[model samples]
Structure formats: structure tokens, C-alpha cells
Target: MDKDTGKAFDFRLFKRLMRHTKPYRLTFYGVALAAILLSGFAVATGVIAGDIVNDAISPKDADKLLFLSLLMLAILFAQVLSQLGFNYYANWLGESIIKDVRISLFQKMLGFKMTYFDRSSIGLLVTRAVADMQRIGEIFSQGFFVIVADLLKMLTAAIAMLVLNWRMALIVFALLPIIMIATRLFQKAMKVAFIEVRAQVSNLNSFVQERITGMKIVQLFTREEIEKENFRGINEKHQNAWLKTVWYNSIFFPIAESVSSIAVALMVWFGVLQNVANVGSENTGIIVTFIFLIELLFRPLRQIADKFNTLQMGMVAANRVFKILDTESHIDDLGTVEKEDVKGDISFSDVRFGYIADEEVLHGISFDVKAGETVAIVGATGAGKSTIINLLSRFYEINSGMILVDDIDIKAYKLSSLRDKIAVVLQDVFLFADTIANNISLKNNEVSVADIEQAAKQIGVHEFISSLPGGYQYNVKERGTMLSSGQRQLIAFLRAYVSNPSILVLDEATSSVDTYSEQLIQKATEKITEGRTSIIIAHRLATIKKADKIIVMDAGKIVESGNHKELLKKGGYYSNLYEAQFMAEEVA
Candidate 1:
């Protein structure tokens, strides 16, 4: 957004972008060779035309003129063939590069720590992958190719023109400084405009995506008009940014064209003066040839200016993309040791963590969970209840202490292996738009239908699913919108059970369900947690009443911890909270 920073256009980012083209080296060379051949053929056509005119007007040898005409046709035909080949290969290379880039970016994004997603918007991320990638592709396919071809053509044309008539060529060459100077001045302005456009686009996308995703909240609050105004403001800013870019481009191209036109006019005037002074004969053939070559020279110059505009836009997009790719993950896998199997024993020793340093969310807390034990963590909202589960899962890194799994520091194990042993059913469940069976057997392609049915039956959702028109084959809409909240939670529970992990984590898994569904979930939880270490983070006091050990949290620390009856007898924070909730229920 700060375009005035001298570091706006980074060459290092351009170098990184170019690395994606490594796989298409052969195509690059092929296109370059084709451009050369095409340029030569184009210049030769002009020479042939001049010869034909001179021969026909003077009644020279017909055979010479005929040969020249045939040669011109052959060159033109070859040029067309080469252009086609070049276009095919260039397009293939550009698309292939874009595909590879998108894949790498996606993989890198997946590797990023969860905190990255916490701070970034889904819309901005999606824009980088979709729209920005397309812009970069256009730069490579059309912009880069045009620049290359134009450079070669301009160089070749200049040389040919000089060879034909050095005096006329020099007159045209004098205008080269104007283009160079104008481009130099326009480059910074264009880069600034493009960066503004890119920022505006990102902001607009974020606003639209957030509003759409939270439309229910808007409707509930009756703030649709407010949201609309907010969106309009962002959209207007984006439009203004684009208009500025358009203005720069409009001024740039016409100015470049005028400079080129002046160059051509200068050459024509000088050619006439030379003929009048008797330095050269007034040979219409030579004059026409010179005119054609000058046109060829200026044509590519104009193309270069156009390509520069596209290149600037690509730079802006790439800058944003690399900014994301360059971020270092705070949580990373360290290969100090590898454990093939974990006993599901977890211990936290003097653990501390926060999204931001110096603002601790979890203090120097310590706890232990033996294998095959259920530990319930309960707290008010924002008491770091979810943060504890996140740390145990290594979604975030602890600041000053270590978390051990089976008495081994979790960092020592491969992240994938560590996570493979644990399954979490979040309070807010998300299901892919797929059949019920496919969602359950997520990791196994060859899971039997009987096994899926068995898991569903164990979760007590089998009967409900069977009542549906398609049973296990029922297709879920996006985010499982086709199903009720309780149904979605049940499916998520089934998914966790099917994974057969050694440790189960249910964070408010039953909070969104009805009383009947909660009872079903409680039964399913007992079945699933049977010989596995389980951790439950819940706000509903009743859900954890039967937990083997209940840990009460307040202000990011464990205030009271004991079994249900013991905590009730202690008459502390846990007792007060339970009493308040009990009174509320009794009044209801």
C-alpha cells in the first residue's frame, strides 16, 4: 500500500518468478529462435517489395522481378509458420509455469502455521491463487513474448536500415533517446499506480468475501444498508485506483506513438534533402525501402511501451504473492527424534504461548494426561480454552517451555506423525461437499461400505442418514449446508472415530446439537474414547460432569481441577460457576 517506499519494485521477486520457467527452457529458446527468423523474414519482404517496384517501373528483367516476388512469398509463409509455432510453445510454457507456481504456492500455504490463516483473509488468499496467477500468466504469455520479439525486431530493423542508408538511419535513431527517457520517467509512476491498484483489489475482495460469509450476522443485526455502504466505499476506491492506472497508460502510449511518428517523419525529410543536394539519386525504390524499414523499427518500439505496462502490473501482483510466500512459519517440524507409535501420554511443563509476543495468552501452565484418560478443560470464553488444544496439536508453538508426548518433546517428532495420532472435532464442524460415506472415510479410498455404515451406526447417525433419500451416498452441499447443525456434528464425530486415532479431542462437540442429539453424542463419545486418551474443551458444564478429571480455567490458568464431586465439594470458582448455571436452569 505504501507505494512511495523506494523498495516498491523488487528485482529479487522478479528473479523468483523467473525460476518457475526453468521447466520450460526449451520452449523459451524455441520461441526466441522463431522470433529471430520471423523478424528476418519481415525485413526481407520490404527489400523484395522495393526491388519489384524498381524492376516493374523501369521495365527491367521480368525473371529477376518474378524471383524477388516468389522469394517474398516464401519468406512471408515461413514467417507465418514460425509465428504459429512460437505462439503454441509460448502459450504452453506460460500456462505450465503458472500451474507449477500455483501448486507450489498452495503447498507452501498449507505448510504455514495456523496463525497465518488467523491473520489473513480467505478472500485475499484466494485472489492470490486465482486472479493474481492469471495476471502473471498474461505477463509471461503476451508481455514477455512481445518484449522479446520487439527487442529483436527493433535491433534487426535498425541494423538493416543503417546498412541501406546510414544517413537516414541516423536521423531516425536520434529519437531513441526520447523513448528511453520517457520510459525511465514512466516506470516509477506506473509501478506506483499498479501497486495502488493491487492493494485496492485486495481490500475489495476481502470486504466482499467477509460480508458474504457473514451475511447471516448482517441480517440478524439489520445492518444490510450499513454493509452495503461499506462495500460501496471499498469498490469506489478500487475503481479510482484503476482509473489512475488507465490515465497513465493512456498518456504513455500516445506519447510513445508521437515520438515514433516524429522519428519516421525526420527520416523521410532527410532522405528528400539528400536527394535534392545530389548526395544520392531520387530513386523511388530506395526511398520506399527506407520508409518501410523505418516503420518496422518504430513498430516494435511502440510494442515495447505497451508490454512495459503489463510488466508493471505483473510486478505488483508478484510482490504481493512473494510477500506471502516469504513469511517464515513460527511452528516447524524439528527432526530430533521419530516415534513410530505414541502411547497418547501428554505433559506440558512451564508452557507459555501467545499470538503476539509480550502478550501471553497461556501462562507458565503445566498439566499431564496419562494414556487412556479423559481430561476436560472448561473456562469462560477467551480464557484460552481453545488455545490449550491448539498447542497440544502443535497448531502453534509454545514460547518458553516444552510439551511432551509420551515423555518426548513434540518438536522432536515429525509433524505429520505427531498429528496422525490425534483427531479433533471442533465446535464448528466443516464438511466437504461430498457423499456422507466419502467424508467419513476421508483418508482411505478403499474403505468398505459396511465399515462406513458401522461407523455411522456407532455414532447414532446411521438411522437418520438411512432416512435420507440417498443414505450414505447423500451429497452434502457446501460446508454441509444441506444438513442440520446436529447432523453435521454427528458426521464430524463419525469422521474422527473412523480415523481410529490414539487420542481424541472434542472441543464443544455437542454444544450446537439439540438435547436428543447431545445425548446421542455423549453415548458416541463414550464408545470412541474407550481405551484412548481424550481431551474435551467445553462450555456446557453438563458435558464434562462425568469426565475422569475436570480442570477449571480462568484468566489463562487452571483455577481448580478435580473430579465432578470433588470440585463441587471444594466450593471454589468451579462451584460458584456450577451453582450459577444450576440456578439459571432451575429458573428456566
Candidate 2:
């Protein structure tokens, strides 16, 4: 859960959320008008009822009462139609606004740097996209409509009561200050309680996602009981939060109702006293009408209080949503830069970078790949091999360094242009839950079937795909979980080959594949890197032995560099790693 204890309600953020409603301004106005008209007609019916009672009971005018009854029915019918219009328009506006917000948020999230994903949780992001957006829609559709209608009803009722008898109106209006004070207190309490509820909800969501995704690992380790206990703890926290909110609301609603009841009592006593002192007879119809109007006022007041609770919850959700939308992506596209063909001459000069501040991962590392050279990087885990490729692709920015392509700073090129020239295949390949052909083409859709088949053949996965029931149309599950590790890697290779990039990066690409797949991948790699600047990071010496140049890294520094035979002759780190691996194989 995000620590929001010290966070205060920001009015500026509320204004930002409201800005999304700008596109539906006309619809909002129409809904507001319809709500006001509907509420007015509702209040007027009480007045008509009073007239009918006075005529039928006291005056004994049956014709007058009959006509008034029909009039009331017509007004009620109009009120219903107006209410339906208000509801339909309000719903349309709310849904449209939320749709725009969700789309904009998704676009912003996609632009965020890779580091954002490393630090953020998938469950939390998904919660914002799905759950939070829905909360916002509820606020607009239900809360907004209720608040507006209640305010209109209250205002109109107060005016009508004042016209009927200013004394009774004053008596009733006295409750306004008391009601305001009560609502203000309830709002404060509900805001804090609802915020707690939202936090607990996020925590519960995160826990459920973790448990489900890691269930296999839990079962393998036989730790189901421990996982259940952890889930129970989170569930109890959510339950406690809800209980606290209900307790606050339980106290608040009755207090508001008691205040309304007190106002009603005062009005009735004063009204009866006035009738007896002056008129010498009870104007029971007037008394009843006054009571009906007061009920109308208090009904919505109670509803408004309830709506306030939901509105506060939605505000909490909006704050979280806006925080994500407001995040400034560290990587931005400078629109002034133009896309152009890249020569593939890559150079890093005095490059320094870090994932976190003040702890440099790459310290003044410098290297150059002459137009179409194949550079192999061999290093132990966490030696910054992947970091180098990440910086080259601008998936991350260098802290203090200059990367140049064709002797020009790569930053000067448009990000899309820079990335378009590069292709990468990592050991962990990600294939969408799509057909094998669609996965390879990445939804370009314009790539011909023949082109896909040729690329698959080049990567030596053509026959394997043909063996499947659906051939090229064979669908892979999310992350290609249905396919073998080697098959996924081969598809990744085909994806890269089809792009025909100027720079190729294969980071432990063949590490997970079997020996037969590895041989096929080696052949594919040679063809893909034939005329491109290639960087291959591999633990296996066999994969890097044929490189034009080899770089051996240790502790974030280049410990050795040379051709395969030259490095072997030097008898340094590379030669030692090679001999050690071979000796281990011989012993086995």
C-alpha cells in the first residue's frame, strides 16, 4: 500500500480530474437542466396536493379537486420523463469521460522508462487501469448527479417554503447551519476512513495477484499454509477497514436524520401555533404541504451525505490514478528530431550509468563497434553486461556519457528512429497470446505470409511450426508458456531477423535452448549479424569463440579484450574461463 498518511487533499488534483469532463460540457449542461426541472416538478406536486386537500375536504368542491388530481398526475409524468433524460445523459457523459481518461493514462504509462516497470508492481498498475477508472465513473454518474439534484431540490424547496410562510421557512432554515456542520464533520471522517479502505483494497489486490501467480512455486516448495496465512492477514486488514468505514457512517447517518427530525418538529409546532392565533382554525392542508416539502429537502440531504461517502472514495482512487498519469517519463521524444537511416557505427565514450543514484553500475566504460563488427561480451552475473545493451538501446539513459552513431550523438536522433535500427532477443522471450505468425510479425499485419514463412525457415523453426496442427496460425499462450523454451527462442530469433535491423543484440539468447536448437540459433545468428553491428552476451564460451572481437567483463569493468585465438594466447580471464568450463565437462 502507498503511504498516504502525510498526504493532504489537493484541490489542484481535483481540478485536474474535472478537466476530463470538458469534452462533454454540452451534455453536462443538459443533464443539469433536466435535473433541476425534474426536482422542481417534484416539489410543485406537494403544493398541488395541498390545494386539492383544501378544496375537497374544507370547501367540498369535487370538480376542483378532480381537475387538480389530473394536473398532478401530468406533472408527475413529466417529472419522470425529465429524470430519465437526466440519468441517460449523465451516464453517457460519465462513461465517455472515463474512457478518455483511461486511454490517456494507458498512453502515458507506455511512455514511462523501463525503470518504472522495474520499480512498480503489475497488480498496482492494473488496479489503476481497471478498478480506479470504474470508481471515477461511479463518482461522476451517481455522486455527481445526486449532489446536483439534492442541491437544486433544497434550494427550490427553501424558496417555496419562504413564499408559503416566512416564519415557518425561517424555523426550517435554522437547521441549515446545523446540517452544514454535521456534513462537514462527516466528510472529514469519511475521507480518512475511505482512504484507509482504498489502501486495504490495493493491498488485498496485490496479495491475491502474488498468490495466484506464484501458486506453482508455493506448491513446489510445499508452503501453501504460509501463503494462506499471509492472504488471511491481508483479508483481515480489508475487513477491518470496511468495518471502520461502516461504523463511521453508522454514527453519521442517524445524527443527520435526528437533525432533520428536530427541524421538522420545530416547523410543525410553530405552524400550528400561527394557525390557532390568527386564523382560529387549523390549515391542516398547509401544515401537511409544509411537512411534505421538508421531507423532500431532508431526503436528498441524507442522500447527499451518502453520495459524499462514495465521492470521497472516488477522490482517493482519482488521486492514485492522477499520480500515475502525472509521472514524468524519464525518456521523452524530442519532436524536433527527425528519423533517418543509421550507419550502425556505435561508440560509447566515457559512458557512466546507474539504476539508482550515486551507485554507478557502469563506470566510464568506453567501446566502439566498427560498422558491422560482432562483439561478444562474456561475464559473470551482475557484471553489467545487460546494462550496456540497455543503454545502447536507450531503454535507460546514461548518467554521464555520450553514445554516438556514425560519429553523431545518438540523442540527437528521434527515439523511434534510434530504436527502429536495433533488434534484441533476450533469453527470456515474450510472445503475446497470439498466432505464431502474428507473434513473429508483432501485429504489423502487413508482413506477407510468405515473408513470415521465409523468416521462420531462416531461423530453422519452419518445420517445427509446420508440425503443429495450425501451422503458421498455431496460437501460443501468454508468454509462450505452451511452447518449449527453445521454440520460444527460435520464434524470437525469427522476429529479430524479419526486422532486418542495423544493430543486433542477443543477450544470452541461446542459453535456455537445447544443443540442437543452439546449433540452429548459431546459424540464424550468423545470417542476422552478417552485415550488422552485433553484441552477444553469453556464458557459454562456444557461443562467443567465433566473434570478430571478444570482451571479458568482471566487476563492472572490462578485464580482457581480443579476438578468440588472441585471447586464448594471452592466457588471461577469457582463457581461464574457457579452460575451466572444458575441464569441468571432461571431469563429468
- Judged by lDDT, which candidate is best? 2
lDDT of 1 by residue, 310-372 (tens): 876777777777777788975777755656667899898988888897999988888889999
Q: Once all C-alphas are superposed, what RMSD does model 2 give against the true structure?
A: 2.2
Q: After superposition, how far is residue 391 of candidate 2 from its true place, in Å?
A: 0.2
Q: Measured by TM-score, how close is model 1 to the native structure?
A: 0.95
Cα distance off (Å), candidate 2, residue 368: 1.2
Worst 10 residues of 2 by lDDT: 1-10
The deviation in Å at residue 547 for candidate 1 is: 1.3
**What global local distance difference test value does model 1 have?**
0.82
Against the true structure, candidate 2 reaches a TM-score of: 0.95
445-485, model 2: which lDDT tens digit per residue? 67877999987877677888898879988889877888989
- Model 2 steric clash pairs: none
lDDT of 2 at 579: 95
